[model samples]
Target: MTPPPPPNLLHDAFSADFEHELRFTRSVLDSSNPLLEDLLGWDEQGPRPGLIAVVDSGLHDATPGLSKAIEARFADPALPELRETIIVPGGETAKNDSNVVESVLSAIDLNRIDRRSLVAVFGGGAVIDAVGFAASTAHRGVRLVRFASTVLAQLDAAIGVKNGINRFGKKNFVGCFDVPVAVICDEAMLETLSDRDWRSGYSEAVKIACLKDAPFFDLIEKNADRIRERDIDASRPVIHRCAELHLHHITRGGDPFERAEARPLDFGHWAAHRLESITDFETTHGEAVSIGIALDTMYSHLAGRIERSQADRVVEVLRRLGLPVHHSALHGEAILNGIEEFREHLGGRLTITLLDDIGRPVDAHEVDPEVIARAADLLA
Candidate 1:
């Protein structure tokens, strides 16, 4: 046995520091607001960095003169030079199309966007994700500033380090993690959202409240009507709290990149992702999440992880908020594919989060299809 000749190896280890900034304000596009200006300000003495703006096509349609406003604002002397203003497909369409990513990349190449430059994305979550993916990969990551244009974007979707486009019939199959320079939640942009779009965001609030803060759940329960009615005053605190909770978990949850077997943030996501794929994304992420939450809660009860009363409270709150708690597809076996995809996505043995009680989450390594069938029936 030739004593394994002198092992040649050198170990390397280093930590990369990151900072996440989230700001909340109203009327962000107005010149007097100074929010956008502050975000992209360039000192007179330093080499000016360029900026390219990407707006969601859906949001552009809703807000007339939005492109003009963005161009006019970034034209200021103190802000980064506005190189181009591009509009991409919005909602899930942004993620579904490879052309959308290519479009943004073309603009980046044509305009010479660089590492020192910035990409300002003004849109809903899907558009943001698609554009963010483009910017992050361009020259190995560019600074990104997000102008969250929907309730869902402001409170949950845009408040993370993920930028992705879906492929191979899986949600976010292709993506990258780049901490954003800033995530701005402007009240004016959300006001442009339709009623259905508005209510879609609160389901995320319900999700965070269920796994982290029971008191927050009470607040949402109390304001479900006002939120559903599109009253920003009643919905503001819930949105902020949800955003903060998500940020907190990302920074302090010990598994920011999900390298562990426990994923508390994805409590109801397994079914939600499946529902979206089956429905061809017509179900809407928020509606699917509402149903997913209720389904998981029902499953938790059936599996003896949570009491019936707790599960009922979870479903009732979603209903009061005017969100769906059931869909016919979930009643079939096709949904089981989500579990396998989820396991593959996480790159290990299956791990799913289930509720033991409000504000308390437990991880289950093995899921019972029988219990899922029973839960689907109960939901029906």
Candidate 2:
């Protein structure tokens, strides 16, 4: 009777604000650059907060002087005190192994990386994702400064507010959304990438262009050769514009944390993620994404959402950039599971982004396996 007398329950809502910052420069570790120092300026925490450096092992191996650079940069009296420089596995290994996360957390605990202190992470997308996860979870959270060293990291992964590691054989299955203190993209780092890694990053550029900007797509299409050849002059614009477009979508698109159903930025990610898992990561994310874009573009054509010529153009661009357009795994039933898995990830009805035309993306409620088979056939 007392419960009945009570008028149901009280309901309320609250909101919080966050700031996301990104910078593009060369030699941020150089003594002349004030960007890193300014970002890490004195706060109530301390005049010189502790900083733990977690670097990608692959990057450390690839770039001969990189370890020396990190040591030199953090040794400066003006910046945060260098706690220790820890080298973790790079690429998918960083995200796949639980030990990577533990090692980072262990380092944080050992070094006492508090919320006010900093975890300056240097690596590609995977290492950043994993290290960021460890940093965010330690003592609730810690200030993180990302040195995005790879093309993919600079253009897409590092700038995002989300971070995570793979789990249960799923890509990014374990992760959280947390903004970093700063995301610094040093273009000089791209010069260290191999031919394959260099080519891998452009697929993301192609992906963003297809979803939101026709002119950007055209620009990428036009400069495919120079980009493939590792011409920084030709590639920098694509990387910058892609980063800007992604940042805009995350902020202005009104769903930075993906609390809703639709995920427009994931234009072809369903198939892409599936392909990566199915291939046991033999197919790189960028290459898998290239294949995903091709598969979905053709599906759009079959669904009458876009013209055949437009779909062909998407495939053509991916190929010109030296990315894969198809994988044998797409024909398997495992690939079909991504639709439901994706829906679960989003926590609602299926919402896949398909293109009505370049620069015009529409959410698809569901995908047909037969139609997907047809798309795969076309790619073949």
Candidate 3:
């Protein structure tokens, strides 16, 4: 018997005056050869486009050869002239730190950047978010590309065009919608990740599965360990499948720009942002998201939106992955206050993604404050 072909991946391209393209490919950067020639529509006959590759500083020492490879590949006179490569540290601290922004701005002057030039962000989710935010704001708007180097970045952050920066101790408080020209996902980079980093990204994979694909959820539960171990062969299909699910919802024309209304796509992010803001970004994004998912699940139960067993199941999966599903470190009152703050932050219009049934999401705009309080009690 032959194995079945992998599911056909689907992505909805949002039609705008600006072009946004998302692609997932293998071996993004190969042997000092820039893939941009084929990936970004470069030909020797045409004028060379300016390019900047932003990498994480943490990988500077570990992957010294990567930067040199990028420089050499882009330096080819036959191809586009690589303007300069900026390397910034990866992680929550790096995203919140303003110094990285300063360094990035210095490397590529906003006045010099235009639609012809491209900004390639090569790091984890935080790095991509920071770079995307910078590129969007630079000169009003410039073309951006994501060479996602981590699992989380490749599957989630790299696909979305939302760019944002932390402000006043808040997560992604300031930002805009500037989708990238393309996103390249290279599985090769996963080999160097530590176990913790691998698991951190796994939370996002699980989140996608829970929100959209129930079959994908089953796949994740069964292959959790293989993925955490960075088994690329076993994990590639899973990553591709999850990306498709996200693309399906995003392209459905349900406010991808996030201007008019909030949608179910932000299922667990409401509480997640508050946690990161309050903790001063001490918590990993994925870890904080796990906690947020649990809190929301509890709230769903209290609101009579979902069954108690469904809530418990969500908590169980998070726990098995070694993610924090409860806020034991913080008091109940603090958690309740955080939720209230979250509500206020959104202008009191709580757009929550609740389970009408497992694998089915119902968007609720007005959730009772009493229900939120009762949910906090359960966590307490």
Candidate 4:
């Protein structure tokens, strides 16, 4: 009888649904606009949702009245009650340190922000990623609203369904996949960005265009100068299109949470992540991505996966956009180590995205280190 009991087996399976919305608007914190009220669903029944906002320290310094604006925006009875506003370090510095994440978590706890409450993160991609990590972990889960303040955040990082921070000298080593309650891209906030920061963001747009839309690539190529010069009119359409494409990939690409092995959207990210770490994040992510894209494009050419003309075109576009196609840090063991790190992150075989032509992406299970070395040399 004991032997028969040992033969018994149990199995179970379940599925959960996820749905969230994103908004592209201007001046989300402006008192006159009802975007915040609409996003929090204040018109509906229940108690007003508690809110805790975390602002980027750099941004706070740039915009002195930001706290007042935040207060005024939530002052309306129809909006969620503003509980506490915490300030955090901006840029990669925010992600490299664990204490940044802890501070946000501590703020969430001290504010008594529950799963029903909202954690509004206002800053560039790094700040959003760090704060989103905290919100996702606190109370097992908490809704996050991203007020994307930079071009990079609006078009790429804030639109992402995943959130993360770097650890162990690795990029995005600590993180989780959790969609935010909503993402708000405030176009007005982009005005205060430095020219360097403005140029830094378009690399992501180039990445998406290279992977999914040839026509979009042409548009970016055409407007590269205006965008680099802070021409908002030229930049706005590019931002909208890039954000749209990113959202489409997340919602329709059937791999929003990256359960699949191949990541088409990460066309140039393998070396990009490595470049950032090796440089101690002196190079911005978008800048590293630009160089990564150039490296991979040249690799694709050298490996006979794509025509050299196409690869040249990619490099040219990045250059025309005021983005770096090469960096001194690319020549190193650390950059090559990224392939294994990428494979570990993918959680199976090594799958990387390459291109046969603009907008035509293919997956490769293995890459030649010799070819990678040659490509880096060429970029150098």
Candidate 5:
């Protein structure tokens, strides 16, 4: 494998910084197999070095196929030892599934593997999140790679090195930052997604557009039909673009590893995270986030924090994406209680990303309870 063009010269320079000393890359799964070569810096050396572990939710066939693909690529007997490969299953349930993480870690032996070994997470956001958190904690740290199979994973969860697992009924209550050595985005993997999964993932893509780029929002509007139909050709660019947007916000400024000064871009996450915990992991993260975005926008409008038009627009886009915009399943009281829980989860003082206008965010330190009540009323 030829050495990856010097890190500083890559097209996505921002990614270089996100990975720290680690490397990052994205490619269509069925396309060329340069990722292994690039990652290992192996030319004619036969097999690349590294213990590869593949984590999948087992809900889809893509995960096993991904592992097979990696194995096939490095099958040459003359190459360096490819080390052992472990496959673990569990999806959203795995986010809080410590047993699965422990199983993966035990297979790799935390004390045995070093930075040279690689933990390749090849599944949806939940699987990636679980394995990533495990890898970050194992042996202090090790090389990590993510092959985000779901749209939500690719667009939002997988890029950031924020590895975490749920605990005490709270989402991401345990975790650390362990950026992947590289990322392989196989758009083909998306074909295996259920319609519900697709819609859930698209909700996140919509959030990114609503918070950062109007043109991106417009693109989604225009291609909504094709995207919903699962048009790989049309959806690939959209997925890549959304991931780029997330990467931009995460590495914008300040320390990438530390969670400090919540940006307005984290708009709905405050409620979204809590809702997930309250629902006992029943609600999809994207579904919770969709409701959170709508509720947050409603709060912004009722508080005179943003225009009613802006709130309506947010609802429109979310509805168009086939996402839930109402908190009807959750009572106003529950939502309020959830808000308090969310704040406590964040150690008090909720940080919300409110829109001054569409695509414009302002960090709000203290959110009024009255505003939350009004927002809940609107959703109800």
Candidate 6:
């Protein structure tokens, strides 16, 4: 055999260092609050940065004069001049429409939004995701300031550095990861949410509490009734703690981009994502997550990873929080297809996060379909 000709080889490897500080605070858009000024950081020597605002259409309707509010709030000399206030569809519908994202991009280009300019997205999680995706891809990436207007956005979705839109009936199929300059959780904005939207936000808190903090779970359990009553005093601390936990996991979890096979933070998400698709998204994400958590908790018990009592407690908390623990879609084959889709999304291995106890999560490579069926039956 002819010796393999001297292998012409060229290898190049280098590390690109990345460091970005994200400000997470409250009351950023409040007229009396001074944090927006600090966030803008005016310098007399430099030109003022321009800003383009994107408000959720639903929010605009609820607040009536929302555009006026944004313009007035950013009127300070230290703050960026409001160039345009664009309204986009809200909720999951916002993400479902590509036109919404394109409209924002068109606005960005037409207004000459640059890297120095800021894209302030004011809406719920879905609107934030759609607008942020546009902002991240526009001019490579422009500074983004998120005004988290709902419980879900404040505590979970808007806290992370990922953005996407669904495609081919899959959740977040097209996306990029770009950290926002700041995420301002305005507690006042959440007041306008319907009762269902309000309760929908707590499922994420329950999810994190189950995986990372038993004490936090206990706190939520204690406050579930008051939270269901729409008591902000009881809900504020939960939102804050949950947001902190998510930030810690993103920064300290060592894989900010999900470059690893094991995704501990995605507990209960496999079924949740699939359920959303199977149901044609008739079920909201938070409600689906609550049901997914219930199913996974049951599976964990059946698989002998967690005690039946532990599973019961999880289901109880979800019920107390007014979250649904069972859905008709959970029993369908399309829902089971989510397991493989989730594995494909993660790539290489099938790693699923399941709880062995409160505040402690364990990863499993395989799940028995029979057991999953039984768990669904029990949930049903």
List the candidates' TM-scores in order: 0.97, 0.96, 0.86, 0.96, 0.85, 0.95
Cα lDDT tens digits for candidate 1, 179-276: 99999998888877888888888888999999999999999999898988988789999989999999988888876776787777778899999999
* Candidate 4 C-alpha lDDT tens digits along 254-285: 88889988988888999999888888898999
The order by descending lDDT is 2, 4, 1, 6, 3, 5
**Count of clashing residue pairs in every prediction:** 0, 0, 1, 0, 6, 0
In terms of TM-score, the best-performing candidate is: 1
| Candidate 3 segments exceeding 4 Å error | 1-19, 31-35, 43-46, 337-348, 366-380
Candidate 6 local accuracy as lDDT? Answer: 0.89
Kindly list the per-residue Cα lDDT of model 6 for residues 254-312, writing each as its tens digit: 88888999988778999999998888888889998999899999999999888898889
Let me know the TM-score candidate 2 reaches against the reference structure: 0.96
RMSD of each: 2.1, 2.0, 10.4, 2.1, 8.7, 2.9
lDDT score, residue 254, model 5? 58
C-alpha lDDT of residue 378 in model 5: 79
List the global CA lDDT of all models.
Answer: 0.89, 0.90, 0.72, 0.89, 0.70, 0.89
**Model 6 weakest lDDT span, ten residues long:** 18-27
Candidate 4 residue 5 Cα shift, in angstroms, is: 8.5
lDDT for 300 in candidate 6 is 94
Instruction: Residues 230-320, candidate 3: write the lDDT tens digits.
Output: 6777678878887777666666656677654455666777777777766777777888788877777887778777788877777777776
